[model samples]
Target: MAQEPDPERLRALEARLAEAKGSKAKPAAAGKDFSQAEVAWRMVLELTSGIMIGGSIGYGLDYLFGTRPILLIVFLLFGFAAGIRTVMGTARDMQERQLRAQAIETQAEHSAGTEG
Candidate 1:
């Protein structure tokens, strides 16, 4: 013979399922609040990638020409300098934009106070 589920148990299970479905889960935090050190770390990673890529290309050229060490060293140093400059420039630009925003906000507040 077949058996039926108890109505009370079925109701309780339904309630639990409904509650679970209705609850909202928080979104995971992305790495948006990176500190200066962390930003530098990321910059270093980019620099390292650039160095590796440039070195690889240089290695290929050197192998074709039978020259060693010269091309790899030059390209890696160039890549490192370029990466540091790019990162520093970005940090500066971010600071400038923030300053401009603050200035605009201050101006607005001053104007509003004068008017009212």
Candidate 2:
């Protein structure tokens, strides 16, 4: 036969656990840093993919048309331009997001300051 558990000990354990949980600081900025890294990678990939796709298209057209290097060069330039454009757009979007976040943070701080 098993003995009954002590209620007093269980209550003490629960209290200790609660205190431990409450004492740990949350890593609030860790997630934001990871997301920023992801965005940067996304921008790099978008630029690289754009250039690759354009180059491939140009190569294929050149081969079919028998225009040799002429078409390939032109297409390569186009691809580079497209990639740059895409990168610029992504940068703009990132800037906008940063500005918005700053504005929100500023507003929150203002509200908090006013409250106290």
Which candidate leads the pack in TM-score?
2
Candidates in order, TM-scores: namely 0.55, 0.67
Clashes of each: 0, 0
Highest lDDT against the true fold, candidate:
2
| Model 1: residues with Cα > 4 Å off, grouped in runs | 1-42
Error of 1 at 66 (Å): 1.8
* CA shift of 23, model 2, Å: 17
Per-residue lDDT over 1-116 for candidate 1, one digit per residue giving the tens place of the 0 to 100 score: 89988999987877787788985333254224447787678777877877777788778878888889888788778777777777788788668766866996799789889999
Off by over 4 Å in 2: 1-34
Worst 10 residues of 1 by lDDT: 24-33
TM-score of 1: 0.55
